[model samples]
Target: MERFQRLDAVAVPIARPNVDTDQITPARFLHKPRSDDHGNYLFHDVRRRPDGTPDPGFVMNRPEYAGAQVIVAERNFACGSSRENAVWALYDHGFRAAIAPSFGDIFAANGLKNGLLPVRLPEDVVAGLIAALEAEPGARVQVDLEAQTVTLPDGSVHPFEIDPFSRHCLLNGVDELDYTGTLAPQIDAFMNRYGRENR
Candidate 1:
């Protein structure tokens, strides 16, 4: 997992609500192995036209939002299904953070484990962000995990909260297994003490 300390990068606005896991990455593409670059399949169906050509009108297809690392979106982003692939698709597609009013519980969890930062803010705040991104295409936003704050394009800062453990893990670029590995010495000592007492 990648460490997320501070990010200052281009942002893309996705104004719709209730964007589901299937919409992020269609179920048909699930058969592909994890080694494959899922980036190509991110928003696979919606970003294309009925004839399977790239839809120029889609925000992602537009040149201005190209290489956007942050997504400012409406409420309930990634709301359907418990598929972890949704997070994978977003991460592989180069998105490091998603800002919204709310997120699906499972998707948020998956995002943290996979190194995608999911930010929850007031609806009005998110709307403001979306408006700014739209008004000025290719605008950049800042996310500082250490401060738990997001800086908008116009220089306003909004704070957010995350589970302490998740924040710690993300800051250090460690997964659950990697964190547990750090406690090996303590675990060994406890096991030795228990064996002596039992015997």
Candidate 2:
């Protein structure tokens, strides 16, 4: 996992709501064992037509939003079943942060563990971000995890709250797996004490 301190980059607007985990990566791409190259399969269904041609109208296919590092979307982003692959796809596609009015609890947790910042803001603020991106293509937005603030294109800022543990992990590039590994020393000590008592 990569440390996420501050990010300033162009934000791609995904206006749709109720975007589920399957839609982010699709079931067909789940066969691959490697996380690499999943970016090409991100939004596979929406980005391709029946004949497998690129859908020109899709926000991701648009030239201006190509390589965007942040995504501004509507409410209920990343809903449905809990799949960690969705976070992988987004991160692989260069999207490090997602701003939405609401998100699936499991998806948000998965994202945090994978170094993707899931930002919760008022619906109006989310709408404003979408409008800004639509009106000005390639508009840059700044996300500072340390400050818990998002700076819009026009220089306005909105604050968001994040769990302290999640924030600490993301800042230090430590995932849940890393946290578990950090407890190995204590676990070893406990095991040694238990063995002596049993003997």
Candidate 3:
């Protein structure tokens, strides 16, 4: 996973609430292997019209929000199903972080494991950010994981909290399994000492 110490990129706003995993990546597309570009299926059903063409009405389809690396969303974002594919779709689609009033528990966990930061803030604060992004479609928001703060387009900075271990892993570019592997020397030493003492 790539390190996520800081990000300064365009943020796309999704004003809807309860955007479930199914919407993020339709279940039918889940059969594709991870090696495939899952980003192509991100919001597949919603991003396209019934005729199969890209929907110009969707926020993500807007030309200005192209290549946005951040998502500002309403409450209960990514709710429903414990599919890690939801995180994959977001990360694969170039989003490194998401800011919202709240998020589905499993989605948040999956995000940390995949190098995507899920930031929780007050409802009003998130609303303000979403409003700002909607008003200025191509505006950039700054995220500093080391500082645990997000700088809005209006130049206002808001603090957020994250699990200490998650923060450490993100800053160091290691997943939980990679982090555990780093403790091999200590684990070996402890095992050797225990064997000698017990013998």
In the range 104-152, model 2's lDDT, one tens digit per residue, is 9999999898889999999999998899899998999999999999999
Minimal lDDT window, size 10, model 1? 173-182
Residue ranges of candidate 2 with Cα displaced over 4 Å:
181-199
Identify the runs in model 3 with alpha carbons over 4 angstroms from their true place: 181-199
Clashing residue pairs found in predicted model 3: none
Clashes (candidate 3): 0
- Consecutive 10-residue window with the lowest summed lDDT within model 2: 29-38
Using TM-score as the measure, which candidate wins? 3
Q: Kindly list the per-residue Cα lDDT of model 1 for residues 119-184, writing each as its tens digit.
A: 999999999999999999999999999999999999999999999999999999988997698999
Overlapping backbone residue pairs in candidate 2 total: 0
Error of 2 at 23 (Å): 1.1
lDDT of 2 at 62: 83
